[model samples]
Target chain A: MSYHLNHLKELESESIFIMREVAAQFERPVLMFSGGKDSILMVHLARKAFYPANIPFPLLHVDTGHNFPETIEYRDKLVEETGARLIVGSVQEAIDSGAIVEEKGYNASRNYLQTHVLLEELEKGKFDAALGGARRDEEKARAKERFFSHRDEFGQWDPKNQRPELWNLFNGKKNYGEHFRIFPISNWTELDVWMYLAMEGVELPSLYFAHERPVFAREGTLLADCEYIHKRPEEEAAVETRMVRCRTIGDMTCTGVWESEAKTIEDIIKEVSIARKTERGGRTDDKRSETAMEDRKKQGYF
Target chain B: MDNYDNMELLRFTTAGSVDDGKSTLIGRLLYDSKSIFEDQYDAVRESSERRGEEGVNLALLTDGLKAEREQGITIDVAYRYFSTPKRKFIIADTPGHIQYTRNMVTGASTANVALILIDARRGVLEQTRRHAFIASLLQIPHLVVCINKMDLVDYSEETYEKIKQDFEEFSYKLNVNDVHFIPISALKGDNVVTKSENTPWYDGSTLLYYLENVHIGSDHNFIDCRFPVQYVVRPNSDDYHDYRGYAGRIAGGIFKKGDDVMLLPSGFTSKIKKIDTFDGEVDEAYPPMSVTLLLEDDLDLSRGDMIVRENNQPEVEQDLEIMVCWFADRPLQPRGKYAVLHTTKEVRCIVKEIRYKLDINTLHRNEEDKTIGMNDIARVVIRTTKPLYYDAYRKNRITGSVIFVDEGTNETVGAGMII
Candidate 1:
């Protein structure tokens, strides 16, 4: 048991080291908080990185507007508790500002629109480093992402061209306009996230566990109740109270939920343990053939 | 009773040249281990159909780049994760192309194991040995020489034995301690996930089994405590204002709360008052744990400084002997100096000497030749502007490893393992 705890401790240390490198190497580094489990774990890890000191960097959220209310509430509360600054880059603002055109007709999620706002915010804030909680195992394109990903002034990521990160020493020098995207928790999988949560006793939003909610089925997945999202003509759902929880949350227009009775953290661990599907499987946006995440990532999507 | 259930995380990297079936081996491991999902399999099948391949091209699962998909080779490090109900593994899938050698160095830096895939038809080729040499220079604890495509070689134990012997004879000069060879056909699923009937003479466990069983808990250095302060934690709060914790991940050994430790670069002594995590507090800390250590005495310490146990201290020096894996496209400058990074410390260092270059194909050391080109593995000496606290790479991979950066270009040119 001691050794087991030691191994977990090792993982935490490596992550913390990366977090510190971000702080030391970059200027105005900010953490991308999605209110998802991965991002939540990242926030938790960032706390350990600079304990006794408030997370030196602020937490940034590229709001898609279409979000589970629980995610927004959790984000505010976590930031408040940690005493870290919170910066919001709203996709709806981008749409309203006419910087990005909202999707038309059915399946019009602001997931893609978040890129414009996020890129603009980074430019305006002069953030030299942005920490994200993206895991490589989540998608094929993400699998090839660098831990300290370099982005051009235009906020474009060239998978072909990246600086090699050798050892614990990270190279963070860049042009005035260029910035780095750091993924301190890049090696973790969904299961590892759950286990760490259990071990750390980290808090989470209620949306993470099973609960009754209004929903509709689309693209072979359940969609949570939201105003902006238009209901498909053929879909029908009863207002039944069923145990359910979200594995991932993005645009209220596209994120889905799975039926489960995993109310407690222990129950959720067991449920996720036997769960065969990946967390991304709950997202309808990624299900759009292959390379959706890749295309968006290239364009600087959070 | 089950050791596998114990927590042990292994970070290994896999690098391969064109047509090395690196993706196949990865897919094979995931598929046979039941890590593959039904939807993922379906997507791969559909993509295979879209690509007009006769069967599922498991490589499609990882070569996510359009250029790589078109060229049928990996161009970047694709990190893959899996667990065998024993040790969880994080694999840095690096490309073996000459231009991608930098990626390989990045991948191998954090790895405890290096799984080198060798085409059975081509025994001990240039790329194969180059990978092995890099693994050795990086001081990877275990090397799994997976002689893949055994089906191409008729599953003959004689062929397996010959390749194994040739590899062993070549690796003798290298510093790799644990070397293993497993003949497996990643395509046919032979000895990758389950025991293979093709080679009954080979009674070894499956490749996955071997990876699962390899002793990696001891790979880390528990002999010396080295904590490189990454940041100074000063939470401006009434409950924790006096709590100026030296925050860093433990690079090696263990540090107890009451342990007397010396702060490096400043040579100040302090006692660890607490090791705090979000889960409240811990009694002690070890290598890789990112716990915040609070000291009873707030001595002069900052980022890039090291914390070590008083009785068990690492050697402090400016000049160090290192075995380096050259990753720059431009050949290493003979007299040029660059910035060297070890742990969180950065110092200026020059290539003091190039002893010899290893012939990757034959695994022979060519003392007469000295070319630190891309993917070149060589022994060299470096003189640093500042003294770094370090242990031998063989002794402590975390503290002994360093990376050189081209100050002008800001590109990481090489990775060195202290000898």
Candidate 2:
């Protein structure tokens, strides 16, 4: 019967609906694009939400300066293809202006500092709502996040005092200066995202598939040999060739790759289907503490 | 290979006492369906070992928040996603404690099915009736009373039938249209994903089986057309100019390409020229499908304006009678003004009167006490500054439900089902 929708189609409809709501409700809204799979999927859904007509909002990229060069290239290409405006809020700018302090040591990352740049961008753009691809299944703290997550004037998320989002009726009412971090795909798990991408034939960065990349092992996780990471003198991390791929894309200093031979989307789906570890298991940023994500989210990190 | 990508989506909410194995039931569902990853299972296993629990605690899987884990209680509603080969499920795992009863209302608001867990040993407690009442009040289409911990009750048919009879007696008072009873042991893995041989006398589909096969297609009202325009798309480009389309998710009924529609408040009439999606134009669009409608005539319409079939129109009124479940810490004061959010529309409203407060446990109406505190359900009469196009809760759920946001704090203070 035509009554039931396929899982992927259903999720697409849901995401499109949320994107439309954000466009309709907020005075000025922007989609947070990281050139990652989830963000790419969100941008793709936004296109579907308002076809023929351009996406009402621009894509805001909170650049960590530690992102892969390929990611930047990919981001520019997508924006060019869609004819959507791109606004870059650089962490380097924040660091240069002494607005945010840079972390030290080998494990130090620009992940946390990106929040400051993001907040600055929101203020600069006067955007009332920021659409993010943060999924509930990504982390424990994210599990409690609402589709329309209300942020205070300081852009801090109060997990304790979240507005009850029931049904498709999202309460977008907010005071001036206070904004919302709306997650259109909050209900989607990592697997659902991968499957949707595969079904929709949406392209992602080359880093997602397996390829020969020079990487080093640190804290029992594979870190890409990039200029962003600072290795201590005592710790020996030699560049070695390995078939690796990123489960979750982020700043090179914080994100880690996993050993995989999955080169195609179908292969990646199969690998993910039987994958034991959580997608963030390879993330060095989340390993900082028990509630690292929650702490950062409270400080306005998406 | 199973085509899970084509499975239909089902959103369900679970309600029960703190120790009634609500989390355990969800864990069982996720674990059995292979939704739980190996790392997640190991993490939970390690946590259980650290806590010195006897076995790998399934309940540990659902206790997602750090505060919940520290306190050993679910403090709020946590949305959990899992999928079977047949269907996809979104479980709104709400806390069962009395203080967090509003969480149950929040969770049940969008659910197609309300899953109420009953401890077999305890039979039907007041808590069970309370949850059932909330589910009925929320107008959740289906009710599945899962009699959990059957192993503790010796898996006896007599016990199952007794509990079923007691449940039926109480359910008679509920307005739930579809109700099913499944004797399950979330801990023992019986009558959950597979049919349990323990209850040979009670031949019924397993919980997962029933969830997959439940008749939810007809759950939505396909009779009355309701399309609350969320946004208007006008691309000022070289390729195509002078094009205006209304973008929104169809709240109810089927909208065809050549349908005559009327816009609210503006009293403008237009005929649908095309129902478009990103992929292409479609023959018809139904409830929950996000599509763009290009009307034959360009009417002055924006967000908050609704388009409906001229013949079947919803009640457009300013005075609303609603059964509100208060969510804020501050009690709702009579004549106090708050922001009322319905669909995509937001309007300022004042509490005109309090019809009565509903005691969830006893289902008693206390008209004497007028103060609507946190987790209290009361029939509130609200007078909005602007008219809200709506329908009765029984007729159309999407348009019927509304949430009140405090003007000062901006917190969603109350959830209401229009009576």
For model 2, the docking class works out as medium
lDDT (10s digit) by residue, model 1, range B152-181: 989988888888998888788777889888
RMSD (CA, Å), each prediction: 2.5, 2.1
In the range B93-198, model 2's lDDT, one tens digit per residue, is 9999988888898899889899999999998987788899999998899999999999998898888889899988878877988999999999988989988888
Q: Report the C-alpha lDDT of model 1 over A1-302, residue by residue, as the tens digit.
A: 34335345556667777898888887699998888888888988887777666788888899888788888998889988888899998888788888889888778778878788888888888888999998888888888887788888889999888778777778886777888888888777777777778877889889888888877777677787667777655654433445689887676787788898888888877876667777788788887758788888888876
Q: What is the TM-score of each candidate against the true structure?
A: 0.94, 0.95
Best by lDDT: 2
Q: Candidate 2 regions off by >4 Å?
A: A1-3, A231-238, B197-201
Worst 10 residues of 2 chain B by lDDT: B1-10
